[model samples]
Every structure is written in C-alpha cells, then in structure tokens.
Target chain A: MPKGPGEKRQWQFLERMLLIRRFEETVVKMATDGHFRGHYHLYIGQEGTGVPAIAALKRKDFLATTHRNHGHILARGADPGAGLAEILGRATGLNGGRGGTIHLCEPKLGFLSTSGVVGGCISLAVGGGYACAQRRDGSVTMALFGDGALEEGVSYEALNIAALWHLPVIFMCENNSAGAMGMAKGGYPSLVHASKNLLLIPKSMGIKSVRVDGVDAAAVHAATTRAISLCRSGRGPVFIEAMTPRWAGSDPLWPELATGITDLRMATGGAVPTGKHQAWFEHYDPVLRLARELANGGEESVHRLSALDEATRKRIADAADFALASPLPAPETALNHVFVQEASA
Target chain B: MSKQSYAAALVDALHDAMRSDPRVSIIGGYVLGLGPQRTLTDRLKQDFPDRVFDPPTSEAGNAAVGVGASMAGMRPFVDLGTASFSYLAWSQLTNEAAVAHYMTNGRLTAPVTFHMLHGVRGGGAAQHSQSPHAMLWNAPGLEIVAPSTAADAYGLIRTALASPNPTMLVSHAKLLGIETEVSEKKSAIPFGVADIKRRGRDVTVVATSLMVPYCLTAAEALAKDGIEVELVDPRTLVPLDEKTIIESVSRTGRLVVVDECPLRGGIASEIAATVAERGFKHLKAPIVRVTRPDTPVPFSLPLENFVTPDPEKIAAAVRGALKAG
Candidate 1:
C-alpha cells in the first residue's frame, strides 16, 4: 500500500538526498582544495539506493553500512550537517569527530555503525538480527554494502548464519558495477549476472532473495516493505540486489575523455548535455525525480521543499561552523578508544 | 568445598554467572557437544540450555555476533575453541569490541567474554597448539586474562564476565585436568593483581598462566638447595600486576620471568623491561626470562619439552639469577 501522499515525507526524502549529494560534491571540492584529509569515496550518482531503502524503514529499524556510507547515513536520518562535520573532522560530527567519514554513526537514529573494511558489517547486522529475534522485537536490521563487498568470504558466512538462525535482516547490495576503479569488464562478466549469482547463493542458504530496479524509489520501497513483513512474521534473512550504476564516472579519466569526445563534435555526433550521457543518471537523478514529482502534485510540495532546503542548509552550515571551531583530538588520544580504559579513579 | 579441575572450575564460573545474570549467553562451535572436548559447553548447555547457544562454524561471524549482542546489552561468552582460531575473528575482537566503547565516546559498552583454550595440548600440532597471549596482550582495548589455578580461573573468569568492557580469558589445555581445592561460592578477582604462590628472599619468579604451577614446583626444588625463590602469578596480562612483581624483586634482589610464549617479544620480555625500568636499583642481577625458543612448538615429546618452559628450565633460571646476583 502506498504511504499516503504526504508532502512532508516527500520533502524529507528530497532534502536528505540533495544534502548528501551536495555535501559529497562539496567534500570533493574540499579534497581538491586540500582542506579535507584522507581518501573519500563519493556517493554522488547512487542517491536513489539510500533514499528508497531508508524511506521504507521505521524509526526503530537499525542500519549498518560499508565505507561508501554517506548516502546510507543521511537516508537513515542522520543530520547531513553532522555528517559533513565528521568528514571535516569536527567534534560536532556524529562520532564526536573521532571517527571520520569511514566510521560515522548516529545511534540515536538507529544508525548502529559503519566500517571502513569492506563487507565487515555484514555479520554485525546478522548479530543485530539475532538480538532482535532473541528479544522477539519487530525492529529489522538493514545491512547495506556495495557490489565489491560480495567478494569477501565473511559475507557468505554471514548469509549462511543469518539464514540458519532465521534472523530479521535485510541484506541490500547496491551494485555500482565497480570496486574502486576496477570496472565490470575487469572484475565480473556483467553486474546483473553477478547479482543473479549472489541472489542464488543466499537463496541456496535458505534466505529469501529479490532483485529490484534500484533506480525506482517506489520499487525499492515495495521490496523493502515485503522484506520487512517477512521478517516480522519470523520468515527472514532476505537478500535484495538493487541493480544500479555509478552516478559519477567511475574514473576521473573517463569523464575527461568523454568530455573530449563531445568537444570534438564530429559529423556523427549530436549536441547533448554532459549530464544526459549515463542512462542510469538520466532516469534516476533521485533528488530531481522526487522534486519534479512533488512539484507536479501541487504548490504545497514546492513550499515544503523550499522550507526543508533552507532548514537543511542552515543545519549543515551550523554543523560545519561548530566542527571547524572545535579542537583536534589530543595526541595522546590517538590511542584512546582503541580499547576501553578502566573506570576512572 | 569440593576439589575441582581447572576446566570444571571454569564451567562452574559460567554456571554461577548465568544463574546470577539472565543476560549471559554463549556461542561457538562444538560449544554444545558437537566436538570431543565437550566439557566447557556441555556443562553450560545442560545447566542453562536457553542461554548456551550452539552457533554455526563461523568464528568471524560468531565473534562479531557476540560483539553485537554485547553492544545490545547482552553478556555473551564467545568460545573460539582455541586461541589460534581467534585469528579468524581478529578483526571483530580488535576493531569492533575493543574499540566500540572509545569509538562511541563511552556511549557503547561491549561486555563480551572471549574464552579460548590456548597453549600446546598434547600433539594438537602447529595450527591448534600455538600460544597467542602476546598477540592479544598487545591489543590496547582488550583485557587479557591468563589464570594458572582453579581458584584464579574461577575468580578471573567471573570478574571478566562482570566487567563492562571486552575481556578475553585464555586457558591452557594442559591445565584443564589439573585439580585444586576451590570454594563453592563464586567471587570476583580484581584485574592487575598478582598472587604470590610461594614466598622466599633470594629471587622473584614471575610467571603467567600454565607456567605459574611449574614455577612453584621449581621453587620447591630451589628451596631444597637452600635457594629461597618467590613465585608471582600475574593473573591478568594486559593490566599486569607490575607493582607486585617489582615489590617482590625489590625484596628478593633478583627477577626471573617464565612464559610459555616464544622468547622474542613475549610477555616475559615486557616483565623484564618493567623490572629494568622500575626495580633496576633494587636488582642484585640482570632480569632473566625463561621462555620457549623463538620457534613454532614442535610435535615430538622431547622436542616439545625442550622448546616449552618447564619446571627444569625455571629451576635453572632461578639458579642462574641467584648466581648473577
């Protein structure tokens, strides 16, 4: 059943997706400007996966994502401003500036945690599922990972255990078709074929599996609703393969080369905007699609977006200011939190 | 109070903890009688069937699950069968459970107890027999406990389970059958406290885990030779009882550390460094360490005996320290 056409929910989703996209773009600029430290994996083109997957979850449901987790964090209701502060290494960040982008967490929003290591959070979500099942709690655990993490052995192990124990977990695989520059050609024969293989692995292990058009938010929400229902009825450990594409060009060279090809404007070539090249981007600019839908509905939708955009921008600005003004962790604290110290004297 | 073996005492401690707290749970392979060494999990399952879980054979997954359960406010005792098997779950123990409290800035607490049977067990061979005390002890966030007696076993394991942070109890397989008089009532033993099993004035013998009893036996033989030996058991390796070891060495004027791990970068080396730094003025001689050679433990009985630290080696180390003093 469609969640009533509430402008509030639509605006909320649009604002979050836009915030994530803009924040990531800003961070990329910051990286270029030498203001940001460490390598950042941007979720620019894949905002659809997070928007839809998280829109289907309740406030009590928990989420654990991989290193490419900014979109997921924002989708699960973390303030984009705090997330930006974290990436900026500010104290106002979700992890108190201790964990940068790679380890962002907002437990208050049921964002359990994120791990830098690929496929590391799979078993953690399974554990969370077990906890939920043991307590007979209706809360579900969504473990989000990229297509690259499928190569890890622990992922398979976690699926097997989750299936055997009948835990309440939703394993959502966002197949971005590349594992940090290794394209599908060099990695797998095809993204969909590989996803089919993954789906089979989980199904054979007794988990219910599904494949959805991840670009379509409604499709993702429907699939998630079904998965959540099955889980609540004590029939889960479900796997969903969301066939999606990288929004930005996978490598910097590809975009540069594409621009050069268009610049040549040969006789056979036609003038098209740089944005319309990728079919995935054209059909699934998640934020744009939601905004267009909301505008078509009525003037109230536009009003909601305008108000939300202002509020979100202000929140992000405030967080950035707070983080920039905060102090860096002390040198001695570098080793702190690696382990829990004894209770203070 | 009845006499109890080290393994039995551990089982009793688990039972007592389960009876006292409803949140305590167990998960691991053969942890519920799927394997031969069914003593630990068998007793647990028999007494507390609901809490003692027979997890699938995925050490990494189970360990991570234990960390999750612990973070969710459950006291989970994860049995990894052997310390060497812990390498598979090293990421979970090191990155997740150990750091969760600090990473979340004290908002998260992982009260998970990792129980492993470490050290050489008969002819278990390379993969199964290796001691990983030094490996775990090096990790900052984890509380590493290695008890050498039934009393300390019950006390330390109970205390670790009660702790709000991640703790690991590495029990030696060889010490499983060693019987000792243990009280029926369970009690908590404070971490970082050393137990003086035997007292003397000539030299201080600092030992850990299975080597503690061997040190005491060696001390008896040294006393027969009119060489007074003091034996110290550092029940917890991470928050080491450096004060007790230093005080004992200060009184005895000599120090000898016996460890089952290899000589290079072992706990013995750390203890020796501690003595050199704190008790250097009181030391009548250089601090000596009796430990296995820097090599993989051999399968042959005589070769294993030669490589592992035993009573003979402890006695010889004491004589050498006395001579040097």
Candidate 2:
C-alpha cells in the first residue's frame, strides 16, 4: 500500500474502477453463457459514473439505483463473485441470485435497492434521505439514474420533495442517452436535450446543482467529495449530473446472436473485439483512463495494475465456478421468502 | 371496549404503529381523508415532521419513494387513497414493490404498507372505484389483505406495519363508516389466516372486505330455507390460508367466492380456482363466484347497485349453487 493519503486514495480509485469494469465484463459473459434466466441490462460503459460517487460516501450512506446497477454495486464494495453468483441464480449470490441484474439489493453494504423501472429509485432516495434527516444519523442518500429517468414524472416528484424538505440526498444522474430496447432499439437521440438541460430541473426545485466530467474517475470522486461535504454540512438535497457515455458506444445490444444481442462478449470465452463499438469501448474506456492515469506513477503503478487485474479475473472466475456449482433453489421452498418468517422456514 | 369506525381504526393503527416505530412514514394522496381519517397522518406529521409527507399528486413517484424508504429501513404506511387510482402507479406497485422480494432472491424485503380504499361506492364510478386486489394478487411478491371490520382493519394494519412483506391493506370504502366495538388492546392479525366469521354445514360462503358483512346478512336469509350457510373471511389474500378454506369447503361440500372486484379473474375467481384445483373431490357443485360484473363500475347509482354483489345477488348465487348441488 502507498503511504501518502492522496496516493493510497488514487490507487483505491483505480482498483475500484477496474473491478467495476471487470464485473460488467463478467456479467456480459454470464448473460452470453445463459446463466441469467431473466432479462439483464448491462452497466458496461457507465462505471465512471457510479464508482467515484459511491467512493465519496460512508458505509452507512444509502444508494438507491436504477436497473443498470452492476457498476453501482461493484463500486460500493459488493463482492464481484457474489454478484456474479447472484445473477447466476445461486443461493450464495448477493441477493441469493433472486434479484438477478435489475432488482438487486444488498442493504448491508448500503446498496438499498435497484428497479427495472427507469425513474423507480429517484423518489425512493428522497424517502431514505428523509429517514436520515429525521434520525440525524449523518448518513446521506444517492439516487443514481440514467437520462431516460428524467422523462418520467417521478424524478420531478423526487427532486421537489427532496428540495422542499432539504433532505440529505444527492440526486446523481448519469446521462448515458440510453432508453429501453422495448421502446428504442438504438440510443434515444430525443433524450439529448433533456439530458443536457437536466441540471436546470433540480435547480428550479431549489436543490443546488453541480456538473462533472464522468469519464474521469478522479474528477467524479472530487466532485462527489465536494457534494458529500455540502450534504454533511446540512447544505444537502444536492443534484449532480455526470454527462458520461456508455462504453459500448451507442447501441448496447447483447453479445448473444440468438437473443437480438450484438457488440458484446460471453462470460467464459474472450471476445475478439469485432464491432466498432467494442473497439471504441476498448479505446476510450473510463477504467482504462483511470488505469492509464495510475500508470503515470511508473513501475509501482504498473506492477499494482498487473497484480490487481490477475486477482480480479481470478475472483470473477471463482465466483462463476461457485455459481455454476451452487444448487438451484428447492421447489418446496418456493413459498419460502414470500414473508420474512417464511424465509426462516 | 370502545366502538370505532373502520376509518378511525385505520387512523388509530397508523398512530400506534408510528408511535411504536420511528421508521413508519406515510405519504401520497393520503390526506388523513375524512375528519376521522385526518387524525392519522396529520398528528403523525406534527410529531415526526420529516417522516410524514404529501408529495406532488404523483402515485408512481410516491410508490417509488415508499418502497425506497422501506428498502432503506423505514416502515412506510402509504395511503394510495383509492384502489382504482393505483392504475397510475401500477409499474412501481406491481413491477417494483410487488416483485422486489422474490426477484431479489428474498434478500431484500419491502415492508411498505399500501393502504388503498377499495370497492365500488355509489358515484365513485370507473376510475374512482375499483378493487384491483385480484389484479395485484396475480403478482408473486406482495401480500394483499382487505379488512371488512374495524377490528380487522386495526389488527391487519398493525400486522402490515410489523410485517416484512410488501402488503396491500385494502380497507373497503363502504366499511369506513361502519362501526364496531373493538378492544383498545392492539389486535395482531396474522397474514394468510382465514377467520370463520360464521360457521354452518350445508354450504360455505367465503367473502372478502365489505362483502363479509353482506354475506353474513345473506347467511341469515338463507337460514330460512333448509340451506345452512358457512361464512369465511380470508382477511389476507396473498398469504391465503388455503388450508382453512379447503377444510371449510370439504365440510360444506359447496363453495361460493363473494368479492367486489370484477367477475373476470378477480379474488372470487382466484378463490374459486384454488378450491376447484385443490379441493375438487370435496365439491358437491361447481364452485360459484358472486362478484361485480366485468364491466367498469358504472356512474349511475342504479347501474352501480345493479352491478355490485349485494346480499340479494349473493343469496341468489348461493341458491343457484345449492340447486346445482
């Protein structure tokens, strides 16, 4: 470990960014391998948005996110293997594999909940922040959503309440210009104006706003640290917009050919990098940016990335193995977990 | 024991639950409604200023907020106002809160209590009145409990607050004014347990929500003839105490599901289907369902009355089931 505080923190950012990158990679692979029995939305290009935002928070702070949450969970210290195992529907997975990709919740790690509904968790963070405000627990909540969520009235409802009450919530929107495939097969260009002008909506509601370059992890961390400071000082209910792009470029179709997937990879087999979007992801990746930044420190940073990459890959592999070996849930226990007592039963 | 209306009981339950747990939050079109209902969250807001809130008339947003708070460790008793209006917030209530626990592999629990006023009251036609529990019940991860009495409301509301499952506590709007004497001591109504409001041998009349009281009335009328009526109230719908219902059906050898929702695939159908599937051999006649017509709740009072499953209609359905037997 590096001795200087700044150096140590910088390395932490690099490690987290890499882990997020790899976790998404493994998830794309798992989806390819048919490990996910349900629908999954990949978080490939959005690592820079979530990793640093979560890094700025304390463990007690709550993170309520949208469906694209793999990056958010990984950034919040969820074991990648466990996360993989979870998506694989194994009992040992993060949500016992029940949440799959879209509805994952790891409350112990302060990852409150994720919803497939676009604007689902925006107002939810407001409620969580309300609890934090009443308790004076010094815990703030972050609502991480994509550009499409802004179109939904829930975001406005959430911001209005958060602002009205001065709740300790940081409304974080990662504008990826993405929409549901059910609605838009390609990216939603109509959402561009909304994404660009999103900061104004929160501002009109009386919540303070800050804009940041989400492509750079350190910049995101610095922005979030400032936001967190403002929140802790009782100047909260802040809105931060990270204008970032998805690494899979414009169309983030799955890698699976049979499932309308394109420009993605399988879990076990490495992708040869065919599509233009894949090449772009390889070239302008945020994790790569952070790694390259860390590598600026010369041999030490180089050696660390080398070791971390190998360890993370092994961790993901072990997770896949564990998930593969884990038993499917018992048919009789289907009634189990309908209620909490039933879970015990 | 003191006499209290169902609405007052709900208000009292809200007060009691909020007092007991600091995490209880109430939000939505949830006005404490009538003067009596106002006593619930109004006082709650005064005491826990930050916890009790009335967000913009946005049910989808409000639903998300409640679920989020519950997920983050708060027991949100959300008054979605009318059950019919829940259609506006269906995506969150159904796709989010309802499916959260099961989808999360049971690691996450949404303990939010959705207090929705259900059934067709005169003038509440169409959007203003609907019993969506049958629709909501189709979802796997939620508990839908409709209480017909003041005691049932108090007990079930308390249970919903204490419960870790996402619960829809549908209190019949018509039952709001109906008063009953209830013990001041807290009533703890466990989910999935059927209450045998009235027991008889010839036929079983399983009713829900306000229909319970009506069925009791019909049971009285049916007693004039040789037909004896057994009445059961499955207070909590999702954790349906099917065992109790099946047993009652086996003894009676006849079953009729009385509900206020639409006839097509509502609670009545679910109950009838459950009994038909599990207790087939016990049936002496085809399982009958006396529910509101598939048509939307009509605006005219006469049309509404004609469509609603009243005591007369229930008696007719029972007689029809008896004739079939």
Candidate 3:
C-alpha cells in the first residue's frame, strides 16, 4: 500500500479533491447550459482548504458552512447525485429540492446548516459546541466560512461567547483574498475589515488563533488536525486563518472557467499550459499541485494519477446524469413541512 | 387552586420545564419581570448553574445560538429582554429559525423558544415599548403565543416549551402584576383555541394580548349601558381560532376589534379583514377597531395615554358598532 503524504492516503485526498473539482466544473457547465436559474457560487479554487479540513472531522462531528458549500458537503462524503439534484431543484436532492444551491445540507451526516447569510454559521457552530459539551462526548463542531464573513457583526459576538465558555469549536476561516480581485475590478467582493491582520480579531477575544497556507493541502490538514485536537481537549475555540490566492476563474463577477478544464497531463509533464492564466495551472491549482507532487515519484505514479482522474470524471458525469434525470417536485406538495404538526412525534 | 401573578406563572412554567427536561436551558441572564419574578430567575440560575448562560449584550448572536443549539439536541429559551430589541435579532428569528424546517425539507427542526416582554408599559417611550408580535406574525412558520391572564400564561408557556417548532412567547410587562386563580394540576393549553372571557348577545369584541383585559372591562361597562358584548381572547396569534371568532360573530351581528399595536397593518386590521372575508354575511354593521394611532409611542405619559387604546375607547367602539347597525 502507498504511505505518507503524496502516497496512498494522499491519493485518497487527491480522489476527494478531484471529486469536488469535477463536481464544481459540472455545476458551471449545467448553469451555463441553462439547466438551472438564479445566481450560484462555485467552489472551484477552495478545494485545498475544504477537502483536507473536512477530512479531519469524524462522522459524529458537526459542521456548518456558508453559501459556497458544495465542496464542503461533497468532502463530508455526501452523495454527489443527491447534492447535484438539490442544486437542480429535483425531488431526489439532498434537501428534497427545497434548499436549492445556497441552503444545501446533509443533516444525517451531522451538518447543522449551510447558511446563505454571511456570518450565520459561526453562532450555529458555537451552539453545536454547547451540545457536544452537554453530551460529554469527544465530538466537536467546525465552522467553515470565507474571509468576507469576518466583516459581519455577529462574528464578534459568537467568537466572544465561544472564548468565554471554552466551547469545543474550530473556527476555520478560509481567507481567499490574497490575490482576489474586488468588485471594483469586476470580481467578487473582498474582505473589508479595519484590522490589519484577521487573526487579531479572534486573538483579541482570547481565542487561540493560528494561520496556515490554504493552497498547501498537507499544511492545511496538519493545522486542522491540531485545531480539532485542541478543541476536543476542551481548550476553548481555535481560530484558523488559511490564506489562499484566489483562482483566476473566480476573478470575474460570475465564475468562468478562465483556465479551461484541467488537463491533468500538465501535472505529469506530457503537456504544458501557456496563456494569461498559465500561473493558475502552474501554482494555484490544488488538483494539479497534488497530482504533480505524487507524479514526482515516477512514471508509474503518472499513469496511476491519470487513471484516478479518469475514474473521478466518470463518477461525476454519472452523478450529473442522475441529477438531470431526477424529477421536479410535485406542485401539490408545495405546502408540505411548513409547520411540524404533532412535533413530538 | 392557587393565586399567582402572571409573571410568576411564567417563571413557574420555565422552572418546571427545566426541572423535568435536562436538555432545556435558558440564555440571556435573568428573564425580564418584576420583584418575585426576578427572584424566580435567580433561583433558576442557582438550581441549574451549568445550564443558564449570561452572555454579553448580543441579541443576534445569542438568538442564532439558541437556534443552532435547538437543532443540535438542546432546547434553549433565549430571553430577548424588550420587544423593541427583538429588531436586532429579527434576522436570526425570521430567516434562520422560522424557515429552517421548510428550507431543509423536514430534515431539521429548531425547537427553540424566544421570550420577549412586549407592549406599552407606562413611560417606556419609543425604544422600550413595542408590540412587534404582529410583525412577527407576518413571518410564517413561527408559533406566536401571547397570554392575557396568569392561568393562560402558565398553560401556554408549557406548550411553547414542549413544541418542536420555533415559538415566540410574548408577555406584556403591564400584565405582569395581575393575579388570578390557576389550578396546580392545569395541563398545557393547545394553540388556535380562543377563550371567551365574557359571553353576551349584542356585539363580539375580538382582542389579543394586553387588549383582552381592557376589552373584558369594557364588556362589563357596556353591560350597564344595555349594550351586551361577547369578548374573545385569541391565546395564540399564528393558529388563530378563526372558527370561534366567526361563530361569535354569527351570534352577535356587530363586531369590534381592539389591539395595542398601531392601526396601520396591525393585529386589529388582520382580524377585521378575516371577518370581512370569511364572515361577511353575518355582519350587520361595519366593524370598528380600537387601536393605537399610527405614530411612535411618545415619551410623555399623557401623549402615550392619548395614543393607546383603553377600556373607554373599546366601550365606545362597541357602542358605535351597535348604533351604526
């Protein structure tokens, strides 16, 4: 069996990351093809932060994420077919087509909520911490949010409460603003906070704070594992700020495949990328970076990585087909679950 | 039977719930009330030292915490102090808690209870005095309970605590000191049930929350003037007892609605619209509503009194309804 980073387990990480990368690509294609309506966020570039971080969580541990939550759900082992169906607003979706893209969640796998509102998941995860404390189990809650969430006022309140109570919560902030183009430049909005460093916000509240490179999957995994251990031991809450350079595809107002579909051959040196977005394929692409790391072993590793990508692509394509075939919810059932009658049952 | 203040009854209900259910906990320090009610909260904190939490002034955050905790196994009762302050927590209450179950496609439920002391209490002014329960009623999926008497307070709060859906238990600060007989063994009161405070023949006066007691007093005054009135108090606003109100209107052709909320799009407006739509054939005269004028509650005591609906105002509305027929 393979061992260590860029080995067997890292290959599994590569598999999960590939699933997310491919799933995101399919979502963009479906949206562009007019299969769905309304604006939806893409998890294209943040796979490094989500995959490794979520892998550190146990089955019983609770998680709450933000609008860009498709990768988080898939990383937690949610079936891509159900996830894609939910995004397509089909009856077989994870939330029965009611939640759609923004509110997609899997409660059975211990996801508390995938809030559409920014800064909404922080307090919810703190609550999960309180529940875990009450159970006296080793379970912990992880709040995965973007850097923009720090600007909202509730984050301050929630961070303070977690520190005071010493709750078992890991506040994982995926700060993707290092190379992000702001709305002023026709891209998504960047973090707007007075503090020079984001980590100071949590540290000021007496929370144990740390920073890590989000693009480095190994570093992210190590940081997340340490944070979860600190939380499990009742060391209050830990605030992790993972700094990542925003992908070129996310530079525009709406996400576009600027660098085009990943070739996977570029990581094995059979092909090369040469364009304005060449830097993305060279450095920022987490999928290519991990693949290149594994392929560095030998030519055998190259064929193995390519084969793994082929299988992941096939699985995602099948999931998309399943979602496309799923039926829309019946019209007469619109008013169901409005209120829980006889809730005790 | 035991005589207890309305506030005391609410405290007792919470105390009993926490004692019986270990998963039930209270947030936001002391529950807002007078003298003995505050003492009861103190005792509650002492008994459940680990459960009660006194977080800093963070309505939005703590409200969301209650929502999150409720979904994750614990039932939390978040005290939001004054009704006006609920504005800070409006998003958490309306967006997150109210829509969780439906949005999640029945995969999750937020069994959280929010307590707020509502309505005008003397010189509470614009910031302190408010009855936003009507606004919350506009948001679907929330169970709104506003009790008018001590016994109703005891029974209704228990039901709210036991409910699996998010519940808003609105208590009027003005009604706290009022005392009435409450059975020690009284069970939980079901929602959507209206209690007829007084039965009469001429006019049906539908009131809610603080307006119920004023309407009852007006019913007695109207009786002396040979204008018999049937007073209906809707215990819960969301699942309103429309059947009882419609049946009462059937008995008495004249209808009068009274409420402490403002006249524009208030509780009175909703009840009047319901009657006009569903029970239109039974009406002999145009319905009259005694409600607070569409203005911010003034700081001056006399201005506050001038704007708010009182017993005399309700009595005049009932007599006018009878005369207009």
Candidate 4:
C-alpha cells in the first residue's frame, strides 16, 4: 500500500534505490574486472531497505554504516563519483584514496563513516546522537548494521545507553539472511524468531521497536517515516528490523563457487526458470523485479530508468579511470596523521 | 600554608583549564556530587554550567561522545569514574580516537582527554580497584600521563587539553587530596620527558604516578644510610623520555624502576628493556623493577599494600641493584 500524503517521497525513494542499484551493479563489474582491489561488501540485495530508511532522515541528520554501506553512503548524498573513486582507491575519492570501500566517509554530508569491524559503528552513532541531543540540534543519527553485528556486545551496550538517555538514534538492522557464508537459520535459530526476540528486547530496555518487510520498499519507507517522526518529536531511541534478503549473488562470486556445482547451476541456469518447487531468478532478483515494475508503470518510466542506468554506468567508468590514474600512497606517508598538531600561533 | 588534597589539585587543574580555554568541557559520572575529593563537576558546573556535563552512567558511550565532540573541534576531558571502567571503553579509545588520524592518513583528528581514577583505595575490592596503566600503555598512538604531584597534574592536564592526539590521564584516587603549590601559568609539561625529583650519583630510581612519592621516600631513606639514590619521575609513558632514562642510567650504571602496574609486560618492563638494550655497556648492575605481582589487586589492606610497589620495596630493590653493582 502507498504511504499517505508522500507520493513525491515515494518517487524519491524509488529514485534513490535505483541509483544505489545501478551504482552497486557497476561496482560489482569493476571489482570483477580488477579495477577495485580491496574487499567490497556490495549492498545489492538490500538497497530497498537502505533507500527508504535514509528517506526518513533530514538532510542535517547523521548516519553511520557497516562495511557493507554503499547504499547508505549514496542515500546520504555522497557524490557517486567520489564514492566510486574512493572504493577504487583514487586521489579524488572522499578520503583522498586513503580509505577504500570499507572506510568510505563523507563527514560534511553527516555520514560519520564506515568501519570494517562489525557493530563498531553502533556506539559511535549513539555518541553522535548524544552529541546532537546535547547541542539540541534536532538531528537524529541512524546506525545501519547487518544481522552479523547483533551478536556483538558493543551493539547491545550502545542500544542500552541510547534507550536510557533517550538519544535520537535509530538502530536500523539490515537482516539480509547471511553473514558471509553462514545462513541466518543456521547461525541464528530463525530470522523471524530472532526478529521477534529483538523486538521485545528493545521495548524492555525502554526503546521503541518495529519490524518491516524489507523486500517491500514502501513498507520499509513507512516504518522509517514513523520512526523518524517519533525521533524528531523527542520520543526515541527506536529499533527497526528490516527483514530483507540477499537478492544478488555475493560480490567476488568466488565464495559462491565453493557452495557446489548443483547450487550454481540452479542459480544461473535459466532466465525465469521454474522447476519442481524450485522457483529460480524470477523470485530472487531485486533489480529485475524493480525493472519489471517500472516497465509496467509506462514506456516513459522505462526510458527514464534506462537514462539513469546509462548515466550511472558512465559515472562508474569515469570514476574507474580517475582511480586508475591516481598514484598510490607513499611508504613514508604511513606515519603521518597519527596525531593532530596543537593549534599554532 | 593552607593544606589541600590531591583531588583538590585536580579540580584546580580543571578550573584553570576552563578559565584558560573556553572550548574545554568535562563529562563524567558522580562529578556533580559531594563525594570524597569534593566534585570536579560541582565546582565547574557552578562556574561554567554549559561546559561541565554530568553524563549518565554510560562510560563507553560518553567516551565515544567525547571523541566525537573532539573531532568536531572541541577539547573534551572525558572522565571514566574508575580505571576498571575504562576496560568497557577500550575499543573506542584504541579503535576510533587512537586510529582516526592514522586511518584517515592525517585527514581527521580526535584530541580527547580521558581522565581515569585507579589504584587500590582501602577495601575497594577487585571489581572497583585496578591499576590499568599497563593496559593503556600497551595501546600505541596514545599519550598516557600519570602525574604524581599537584603541580605536574595541573601543568600536564593543561598541556594534554591542548594536544592534538588522544591522551589518557590516569589519576590515582589515593592521591586526590594532596596539595601542592601549582603555578598559575598555562605552560605544558612536555610528554615523554622525565623529571629528576631528586639528584644523586649512586643509582637511578625511575617511578611513575603514585610510585614517584614512594621512590622519593626511598631515596631520602637511602640518603640517611649514605646510599645516595636519584629519583626519576616519568610523567608520561607513551612518548617515553628514553633520552632522560638512558642518560640517568648511563651515569649511575644501576637502575630500579617502581611501577604500580602488574609485573608482566608492564611499563617498568618496557623501561628496563629499553635501558638494557641502549645502555648495556654502561650498566654496572642489572636493572631491577619494583611492581605489583602478576595478579589482580586484592581487597585486604595489607595484601593490597603488599601487592602495590612501596618505598621499602624500592629501597630494597635499590640495595639489591647496588649489591650487584
């Protein structure tokens, strides 16, 4: 169902998701081509969750993300070229090529940054929210993490503090079913069970909690809108569990290779393959579903999407060229920036 | 002259820093209460309520918030009620504050001052009491300061507030009420530089924080016995004043390091290793260290005292070094 009184926002949400999807697809291809060297945790299957969650945020609000944070970075309004260039390790990147994909940050845009360590950003976001509340800046902070981060003690501690202090922090959990190779069901008893457990856990700690169907962009957007409104009105620390799935194959594709030949054949065998109770790509591809929905909307929407895809592709290519041309950091420069200099005369 | 305690000296330091730099802010728990050493927050809050923040009982979150404020160009003095509580904030101090500059390759800086109160205080048992200087000293890219005197506490704290790197000032709860004539100047006692508390030629006794007073007492006692001993106070640990330590050891050819931290991989061990490696040829005796045994500080007064390095221990270690010499 469409969210009432925010038709324009729905379109904006779709645009942001499209941007993230196109950008990530381009990044996957670049990584495959060896242009991007470091570990890239693509937010391919989970763009719907991030796009709408970010839509709930004001421009001045702050956010922090985990290693898999390309969607959050884009939603926070970082220049796509700068983000792409950073991931590619270019001088023109957000952190001047110093921080690659795992550490992409745009502080000016209120995106505090990303840390490769799981659940580390949770406390940082709580702190940021506390600072904002102390300053009475009316800005909320969103901490975006994966299901893998829930097990970390720091995340729990952060949530407790945020709740106790009534910090304007939104804990956005992107439950994408897997942490690397471990399935949610195998690692956690069950994703649905874990989600329910988390819901009561936050409420018991005096935090407001919600669960949303992350695959449905509109549902994610509606939950975010409510959470953000409550936070802005001085009634939060809120918890959101976006039950999304990993629609695309994990980046690098090398890890999937180890899953066995049968699985691989089933995954890539057909365009819209339907077998004995085994629905194929048609049921799992997030981008394909989005494209089909847009195509059904009108010929004009399809044309606009194609233009967006072309622009995003060109931007990615240009970023790759820029990154390739940039020089690697000098060995001597390694010791630099360990400490800031005392303010001078 | 009016008498005052060590805690009062720290409050004075906080007051002096706030008077000098408008940007300086203090955040901690029970800082606004009339607890033992009065309250650093109570006095500052009366004077500058906006600057002195009494945060909730969230040590890690508050520390990280202080870090964030520092990143936003504010000089924040974060107080972890006790040294034991600092363990909860290790990740923030080590990961974010310490590594921000290096990770960003000089693009960002977190100039946060963490003030932690530690050391055995009466019957304050295992959970409440712990000397965590060793744990903090192990973390690279952080400036660790432990001042024994009120004057140094005032001076060094002023300097740490102005520093661009993440700094930790571990104050001993036992030393808070001691009074000394602190200078009004806002001068910095440079980090990694050791002070010669007492001059002697027979041997060099290196001490830190609360151990400095014990070493001084030991030096005086040894002086009466005609065993002249020098006392060296290494106010800062990280930028360890290796030059001063080596110079003193080279001249005396004997060394005794008194550290409150446990023996295993403690700051004393680091100092001893540095001297042994650098001043090996000049050494007339093996370097000895007087520190707590490799175990947690206990609750019993006698046991805790025995566990902590004292003047008698330093004096004995000095005599042993002299005998070896």
lDDT per residue (tens digit) for residues B2-48 in model 1: 78778778777888888898888778645322233465657677787
- Off-target runs (Cα >4 Å) in candidate 1 are A1-3, A6-8, A178-196, A253-281, A298-307, A338-345, B29-40
> On TM-score, who's better, 2 or 3?
3
Q: What is the TM-score of chain A alone in each candidate?
A: 0.82, 0.86, 0.96, 0.82
iRMSD in angstroms, per model: 2.4, 2.6, 2.3, 3.6
* Candidate 4 stretches greater than 4 Å from native: A1-16, A26-40, A55-59, A79-100, A178-195, A218-226, A248-297, A342-345, B1-3, B16-25, B31-35, B38-40, B45-58, B72-75, B184-188
Which candidate ranks first by TM-score, i.e. highest?
A: 3
Per-residue error at B88 for model 2, in Å?
Answer: 1.6
| Stretches > 4 Å off in candidate 3 | A1-6, A342-345, B33-36
lDDT of 1 by residue, A1-345 (tens): 233775566666667777776666556655666665776676665676778788888877777787778888877777776787787776567777777878887777765546676767787788777767766669788888877677776777788888888889999988776433444444222234345466787878878999887766667778988998898788997899887655544444222122121111111122333554544323555555565566665555556556666675676666566656766655665555554554410
DockQ of 4: 0.35
TM-score of 2: 0.88
Clashing pairs in 1: A45-A247, A339-B141
Q: Is the docking of candidate 3 incorrect, acceptable, medium or high quality?
A: medium
Clashes of each: 2, 9, 0, 7
Cα displacement (Å) at residue A178, model 1: 6.8
lDDT of each: 0.75, 0.76, 0.87, 0.73
Q: After superposition, how far is residue A305 of candidate 1 from its true place, in Å?
A: 3.9
Per-candidate interface DockQ score:
0.52, 0.42, 0.57, 0.35
Model 2: per-residue Cα lDDT over B176-246, one tens digit each: 88887798685778777889998799899898889999998898999988678999998988788888999
Pick by lDDT: 2 or 4, better one:
2
How do the predictions measure up, each by TM-score?
A: 0.91, 0.88, 0.97, 0.85
Give the least accurate 10-residue stretch of model 1 chain A, judged by summed lDDT: A259-268
- TM-score of candidate 3 relative to the true fold: 0.97
